[model samples]
Target chain A: MTTIAPAVSGRRRTKSLGSLEMGRPGFAWAIPATLFFGLFAIVPLILVAVLSFTRWDGLSSPELVGFENWSALLDDPIMIKSLWLSLLLTVLGVVIQTPLSVLLGVWAAGHQRNRAILSAIYFIPLLLSATAVSVLWRALLDPNFGIPAQASWLFGNGNLFGKQATAIGVLAFVSTWQFTPFHTLIYQGAARAIPRVLYQAAEIDGASTVRQFWSITLPQLRNSMITSMILMVVGGLTTFDTVLILTQGGPGTDTMISAYYMYEKGFRNFEFGAASAIALVLVVVATLVSLVVVRASGYDKMRSTLEGM
Target chain B: MKTRFTRTVTGTAVLALGLSLSACGSSDSGGTGASPAGEESGQFHVLVYGDATNKVEKQIVDTFNKTSKVKAVLDTIPGADYQQKLQTIINTDQAPDVFFNWGGGSIAPFVRANLLLPLDDYIAKDPGLKSNFLPSVFNSASVNGKAYGVPMRGTQPVMLFNNKKVLADAGVTPPTTWDELIAAVQKLKAKGVTPIALGGGDQWPTLMWFEYAYDRIAGPELFQKALDGDKQAWAGEDSKKALTMLKQLIDTGAFGDKFDSVKFTDQGSPTLLANGKAGFELMGSWEYATIQDFNLKFAKNDLGYTNFPSIAGGKGDPNNVVGNTNNFYSVLKKTKTPKAVGEFLKLMYSDEFVKASLAIGNLPTTTNTEKFLDAADNPDYLKYQFNLVKQAPSFQLSWDQAYPPSGIEPIHRAVQQFFSGQIDADGFIQAMQALPAA
Candidate 1:
């Protein structure tokens, strides 16, 4: 005991000395990243906020219109509908993607050759660009000559794009298909980081495999779940390219979500002011949703699941 | 500690230097576009819609550069984003000296902004600039009786393009009157085929049906009056009659229910026609080239085109045509070398321009176009379009182009909604009446 005490004290003294010598990185260390973020994100956001208060048709000089665009947007039915649709699509994405990715991720965490091979194959859809994926699905879902024609029993008349429900379903399914692997990868990394000692203790207590998973694995994944959910919520709210290439806010604007509507107003209709207002609303909404999720999930507290252990 | 601090400082300085250098490079490049007239002396930029047609524009620019001391550099914005990018850059210092425009409402906004140069003086100096092209085509670019653009490309008149085999199989000949067209639609539909391949997803393709129906029933006067800010024209009985006829066509299932799922831009509707799933498609003359590019064998053998069927007792002349009259190049007022710009405009009527445009299956509206018709590929097709335009009493610009650019989305939405049965006749009329005047 005496010999061990002196050795432990000596190690602690060395650790203290090493830490004292190592200086913390200064503000200059963050300069490059801060500058990049300022130029690309913050500057453009400020400009968009300024433009939202003006009437710019992109041809003539922008005229300051004050609250005109904001008031008009408030009264616009399409604007309201678009907001609702954005929320619906976003919620659908989370509901469909969360459980799917979680299961796949936990399964993929196993270090089996088959699991590795299957996960690699599943990751391919995530690598393709949103444009390429939308086009590929559009061709696949075509009513006359695509997979729908071959599987008419499943898809009646295959008017998936001409109706609202099916159109939204396609958007949700396509997004889930394209993005699940990304979330799965996140969960897999977290799942692998889980302590094996907890599982061993649960097994000693006569816990079944399912019960052990429910008691330990899920609780351990709390932090990763919050991270993955926030990402999904933001991704769904800003879904644009898939909608543009697939639906084009069509079947009489039934599928017109906020992002595409903003594009239509800005690029197609040349109503820059109104579009900027819509953009700001999108940004605020995404931010608020993320904040609510972070707060409700207790993610902001930064409490570690392994704190007691 | 000092060494690490120095390294950090050096790294940041290097990063700062690199960033500033890149920023300087970008600014220098941007200055080139802005100072083309002064700093980039003896040269002007000619921006056009980027497409297969750009090859001709490039050749024309090369021809001009070979002779003139003032060189013309050709730039192209891909067709889809051309209008938006043009408007964004037009009033800025980066604006092209000469740029492509659709001539009617397309340029009206630029003209109103005083950004465009009036070409009356140039035309006065060179009578051939005014006289070389067809009067109907040239007058399209003239706003408020002042010429502002030179017709550069071929005219595009919407035609009823059909699959010859499909029509023959269905025993339906190309209709020349409204009633006969309805009968043909029924016949084709009865044969288990979509009578018309309307790319409703695109919305603009759906608008072609309305343009023809309105012109045939209410005459070109109604739309022109509407464009001239006469809202009453949309509420007129003739307007209602046109809507009724279009509604009947839609109710008859002429376009299959899934048309809203298809798009012309992606070769969806054209593929439907080529594959014999659809009997007809009313599309611009460019449809010919689009199909030819994809399925050369099909375009060569089965593609058949005819004039839009006329209404029997219509107020409009049976010979009235509606589509893009022609694409034109309008000069920016800020151009320093108006003389060099004039020399470039002169090439629009040059023999080389006409021949090159024709070889690519473009029907140039030049008076001398007929002279080289035999020399051009698809001479028969070129001659057909030439005569159709030549004989037409009024070549109404497309409703989308006749209305200011801001009105396009509303117009497309109204027509699509009407066709899809989301709105009735009254809804369509109110929508049309509410469009901002050109």
Candidate 2:
């Protein structure tokens, strides 16, 4: 009892000491970080925000015209369409990818051979650089002499990229194809950490594989599922490289998204000021969408748990 | 202590980035500089659009450097990124001494910004430089009655290139009239071949068909007026007729259904012509040399050339040419060595430059080009283009190049939409009228 008293008192002393130092007047440790953030993050953000109100050729002094760039957004049909498409891709990507990843992950966790072969196949896409994937798919989907064209009996006319409906659909399919495996790997990790005794006990009680998965496997994987959904929303909103190389927003601007539109404005048109405006607007939209995703999808629980840890 | 170290590291990185952005921004937004000319003693850099034709440019620059104490250094930017890179660097102190340009609208903005050196004084001292080239070709690079660019390289008149074996297989000769061209499309389509190879994937190649059609039906005056701010000209009866003909060709399946997927930049369209899968391709004269380099047998035994067909009773002369009349070399206002650069301009009209350019498949527009036609790689092909250029009553510059940079993409998009049946005649006219005029 005497030994325990000293240990408790020592821990209390350290706690009090930490609280005492928190009230120090100087910001010696914080000053460098604050200044660095002010210089890089704050300064660049303000520059972009200010430039959005101007009209400038990239090579000349910007001419200020307040709210003009913002006003132009209303008349710009392509910009509006791009935003809607980005949101659609975000929602659809999560809905499609989550189920596929969860099923594959549950199935692969059963045995060593199943895990090895399925993991190898699923991980192959993540290994490829975005550029190589885009070009390879372009050739494979070529309407003249490619795999789809040769097997036209299955893929009507092999001109899937020509029609607007099919092109956007195919774009979503390609995105899901490349990204579902990552989510699967996350779910599999979570599955491994689950106690084997829980499953064995459920099986002895005559619970089927599907019933055990529904009651035990799913409840255990809730945190990983939420994490993956948030990541997917962020990634889907910013899909630039794959789209740029594949269609180039073409067959007459059918597949253009916000990122590509921003590029076209800045690089192709040399209208840097307007492009900056588009970028800031995109950032704001993404933030709001992400907030809604987190609140609606139980991400607060995971974040709070992390904070507590 | 650990927190302090991390803060310092981040602070340094931020400071570095801020300094970098400030430095790059000044040059880009510099507008114009106060200083104009530089000393004319040392070597001057000349930037060219890098492509297959750069071989000829290198030889000419080498010959000039060998003779003059003030030497010229050559730099090439890959063809795709040339324009954007030039715009970025031209405002900086690192601006090229002289640069390749399409003249007219391509250099108009630079000229307006006063970034170009007007060559009028140089022309006054050297009469031969102005007089040696054809007036039409020389006038291509002129703005407001003052010459801004010297005729460098060669003329590039767009011509109807064909596969001789493909045409023979279909039992059709090269068409000389609009009706005959339509008939040949029908014959070629019935023979199970893609009648014409079009690189619609690259937007500029799609514009050539429109250039020839508009020039043949409405004449050069129509586009000249349209360019001069008569937007109503786009809605005129003659313009409607030309658009109708293009629609007819598309409907008859002259270009295959998959042309929108093929590209000239990647050699896809050329491959079709070379492999005898297509009967015809309307392309720049450079196609002859390109086909030769890629597939020697096709260039030797099967490549064919002819003028764009005349539209009967139309407003144009049958011999009117359309395409890049010639590419030019314009002087930068910030050149470190102006006098030496002017001396180098004289070499463009020199026999050595002409011969080297002709040894490749370039059709030099010099008045003395006639003397060296026999030295051309394919002399017969050279004679055909030479006669075509010499006899042209008017050479309509490709609309995209002739129009300002701002208008190029809109023009390309409208044409693509029309050809794909996305827009009608009135829709196209509205799009063209919406374009800002020079």
> What is the interface RMSD, in angstroms, for predicted model 1?
9.9
Give the TM-scores of the predictions, in the order they appear. 0.91, 0.86
The DockQ-based CAPRI class assigned to model 1 is acceptable
- The model with the greatest lDDT is 1
What are the per-model DockQ values?
0.31, 0.20
CA lDDT of B313 in candidate 2?
Answer: 73
Q: What docking grade does candidate 2 earn?
A: incorrect
Once fitted onto the true fold, the runs of candidate 2 whose alpha carbons sit more than 4 angstroms away are A1-41, A104-111, A114-118, A303-309, B1-41
Q: With candidate 2 superimposed using the best TM-score fit, by how many Å does residue A263's alpha carbon deviate from the native?
A: 1.7
Candidate 1 per-residue C-alpha lDDT over A1-309 given as tens digits, one digit per residue, 9 for 90 to 100: 235435545666788688889866689998998898567555666777899999988777789999999999999989999999999999999999999998899999988878988999999999999989999999888777788778879988877887889889999999999999999999899888776777777988999988977888888898998888877877787788899899988777788999889888887778888988888887777666765676677665646576555
lDDT of 1 by residue, B314-410 (tens): 8988888888899999999998888999999999998999999987878888899899998877777788889999998888888898888889988
Cα lDDT computed for each candidate against the true fold = 0.85, 0.79
lDDT of 2 by residue, B49-104 (tens): 88888898898889888888888888787746566667767776667788898887
Q: Distance (Å) between predicted and true CA of A288, model 1?
A: 1.5
